[model samples]
Target chain A: MSAVVSLSNVHKSFGAVQVLRGVSFEVGPGEVVAVIGASGSGKSTALRCINALETVDSGEITVCGHKVHDPALDRRALRRDVGIVFQSYNLFPHLTVAQNIMLAPTCVKDMGKAEARKLAESVLARVGLSEKADNYPEQLSGGQQQRVAIARSLAMQPKLMLFDEVTSALDPQLTGEVLRVMEDLARGGMSMILVTHEMAFARKVASKVIFMHQGKVWETGPGAMLDDPQTQELREFLHNGL
Target chain B: MSYQFDFSALLPYWPVFLQGVWLTLKLSALATVFGFVVGTLCAIARADGPPWLKTVVAIYVETIRNTPLLVQIFLVYFGFASLGLKVTANTAAVAALVVNVGAYTCEIVRAGLESIHKSQLEAAECLGLTRTQTYWHVIVRPAIERVYPALTSQYVLLMLASSITSQISAEELTAVANRIQSDTFRSFETYIVTGALYIVLSFVVRAAFTLFGLVIFPRRRKLGTAI
Candidate 1:
């Protein structure tokens, strides 16, 4: 199977501080890649670069067959193929759940209201939020809000999804509900690159694991490699219980 | 000697006073709508447009905000005449009021725009929304909602300030009162009646804004809370 996302020797810097240096990774079709690392380890930056949220200073990054590093690239088309969810959920507080999910398809795809509403219903059902369609984001719990965020992204029918510490802000129980939704997405064969601290979920759901340390890919292999220490950094990171 | 109060003297001109009140409401409504549009566009330009546009909007906002509204009304009324452009007193009044209120509205809206989280823009961008689309759909309404109360208060002040337009003889409420007092030789009673009318007009304006806000921002209605 060919790769859906490919990043080779990607480098990025914000001001004088370099966030990503010579990072390389690939996510194949239907693959779930979990990137585990300490703060400032560049895992999240790498995910952002694939979505072209952060421009790479050097090297190539491609997503869904488009060269994201190319300045002439059709950025809107690339973005349509890539969906990203942040820890804050970022749902439009003024809109109801269905409106939030329907906004992109209607605006970007020019889908009609009836069609968008139908798509919204299916996506909300996928995220287990059918009953909250008319509710605002503030009315829902953190976990339900996150699920609504997930449904909003899923409504776009993206080729690949990026999750940036989506559960970091939630309690353990809330985190489990979000994780379950993500697990269902994985089971449905959606390609995903998740930057996470949930080691056990990564071990269980991630087909390939990339452990980053200090702005580079330090260790990488199957999920089981997390068990055997190919590098001391991965072992210490796992032992430290993040 | 005890002074006798005579509100009876002003009773004959009640129809004239009502006419003035009606004109004031109409003028205030026009100024409020156009001022809000101009101000919202200026806010967007200042917050996200090119550097040149930002500088231009900044100059407009600061110049209007720092100068007195009375001077602005004079400029709009007399400056046009000086330039050999003849405009009616009412047209000049409406133009002056819109411009004056627009500058204040721009600053209030700019604060609202700035308070939007960066992640909101990022999420909209990832959804393939163009900058304009993202702003209209995701950023503008919520920002406006967040600052609706501030906007409403600015407009209330704008309604009160319309009385200043009477100096140019716009035939609005205060101008009508000035005429009535002069004609009837009841300056004290006429002024008192005008003051009461102004108070009533403000309450009507406030109620209209409350109803309008509820319609435009239905989430506030549904949730009974600020978003």
Candidate 2:
């Protein structure tokens, strides 16, 4: 099967600082890829560049066969196919959970309100948040809000999902709940790229693990790489935590 | 030779004063509605439009805010007459009030729009919402909510400033008070009563806006807290 996402020689810089330098990776269909790195190691920027949220100064990013770096690519169309879950659950505070889920389908796809509502309800139920449909983001716990954010993306039926340290903002208990939902998504054949510090979850769910250090990929291999990293930086990173 | 306070002298003209108050409410209500519409549109342009549009809005806001409202009223009332527009004083007063308050509202609303988190816009994009949907759902609605208190305060100030229209003999509470004081020779007492009426009117406007906010942001009420 072909890769769902491909990043070739991706380079990005913000003013004088370079974030991602000559970074490259591929994620196959229905595969979960985990990116482990220290803060400011360019992992999150790499993920953001895949969706064109951050423009790459140079290089190619292809998601679901669409070239994201090309200015001619229909950005809204590209974004619809690749959903992103932020560290902070950024649900529309003014809208109910159901409304938040229904917004994209109805607005961008021109789906009818009733149809959108039905799809939203089913997706919310899939995330086990059916009862909180009418609740606002602030009314829910952090875990529930993150699940709702995941469901909001799922409502779009995206081809690929990018989790940018989604649980980093949550408490330990809330993080566990969110991770469980992510595991459920992975089991259901949803392709995902997760930038996370949860070594155990990365090991269990990731089909491939990548270690990024100093704006480049330092190591790439199966889940076992987390245990026996080849690079000194990766080994030191794993040892320091242990 | 002792001066006695006589409120009874004003009793006969109570009906006329009430009519003036009624007109004042009508004028302020119209100006506030029109001003809010203009202000909201200007704010959207300022926040999201191209640099040229933003610059134009900036100039309009600064010009209105820096100048005295009294001069603006005269500019609209007398300046328009000089230009041969021939509009009535009351119409000119309302027009001036709308233009003046619209600028201040634009600034307040723009700040609220700027306060929206960039993450919210990204979330809207990931949801595949159209540009218009993103604006209405993510930007405009919440921006308005965050600035509702400021908007109401400005509207109340606008109502109080309706007194300035009396300079051109446009019939309002202050104008009535001016005529009553001159006729009854009780300048101090007449202004005191009119000032009290204005205080009461400001309270009424604030209560109305509070109710309106409750209706518009039902989620805030249901959630039992603000985000």
Candidate 3:
């Protein structure tokens, strides 16, 4: 099967500091790939670069068969095919949850408000927040808001979804709720690239798990590699967290 | 010389003063609408335009903000005449107020726009929204909402400052008071009544904005929360 998303030898820098250096990864259709890393490991930057949120200094990133780094590619169209969920649920504060989900569909896809509303309602139901459609982001709990954020992405009907530590900002009880949503998405065969610190969730749901350290992928294998690691850095990092 | 406070003497001129108050309201309403549009556009250009455009907007904002409203009115009225652009005093007053308030509104709006998180822009981009869609949905609406309180206060202050335009003989409230005081020779009493009229007008403006905020931000009302 062809990979749904691919990043080859990507290099990214913010001023004098290099955030991503020679990092490479790929995710096939209907697969969940978790990128495990400590803070500042460039894991989030790599995912952001794939969506063109952060411009890669060099190398290739292809999402849904479109070359992301190429100047000729229509980034807006590419982004429509690949959705990203933020760590801090960045929903529009002034818009209702339903409007938040319907925004891209109506504005970008040229769907009518009625049609977008129908889709938003369905997605909100799918995420188990249909009743909160008229509510604002601040009114919902962190986990509920994150689920709304997920539904907002799904409403666009993206081929691949990027999760950049979606549950990191939540409390433990809330984290479980968000992780459960991701697990449900995975079971429903949504292709996802998750950059997470949730070791347990990574092992349970990810088909492939990657351990990144110091702006590079240090190890890659099945979920079991996290438990039976070949690298000292991964072991030490996991142990320290424990 | 015995000067007793006689509010009854001012009662006869109440109707005339009311008309002047009405004119002041109209002028302020027009100026606020036009000024807000100019301010919002200037802020957008300053924040997102090319470096030269940014510098131009910056200069306009800073120059207007730094100078006094009195000088700005004189410049708009007499300066335009010097350049051979003849206009009425009322038009000059309206134009001056718009220009003056537009600068302050630009700065307030720019601050709100800057407060939007970079992550929000990325999220909007990832949703496949076009630049314009992202701007309208994620940037402009939220920025305007965030700075709305400041905008309303500035507009109220603009209404009070409308009195300043009477210097150009615009026939607004202050001008009417001037005429009434000269006719009645009761300067203090006339001003006292005019000041009360202004207070009532400000309250009306505030109430109108509150209703407008309710209509514009229905999500906040529905959810009973702010973000």
Per-candidate TM equals: 0.98, 0.95, 0.96
* lDDT tens digits, residue span A78-164, model 2: 987988999998988888999988888888888999999999999988888899998888889999999999998998889999999
List the lowest-lDDT window of 10 residues for candidate 3 chain A.
A71-80
Which pairs of residues collide in model 2? Answer: none
Quick one: best TM-score, which candidate? 1
List each candidate's DockQ score. 0.91, 0.77, 0.81
C-alpha lDDT of residue B54 in model 1: 97
lDDT of 3 by residue, A41-108 (tens): 99988988888877888999888889988978888888788888988999988888999999989888
State fnat for each of the candidate structures: 0.95, 0.89, 0.95
Model 3 scores a TM of 0.96
Q: TM-score: which is higher, 1 or 2? A: 1
User: Which segments of candidate 2 are over 4 A away from where they belong?
Assistant: B183-189, B223-227
Best by the DockQ measure: 1
Off by over 4 Å in 1: none
lDDT of each: 0.93, 0.90, 0.91
Pairs clashing within candidate 3: none
| Candidate scoring better on DockQ of 2 and 3 | 3
lDDT of 2 by residue, B112-226 (tens): 9999999999888777777888888899999999988899899999999999999998878999899999999988778878888898898898998888888898876775553
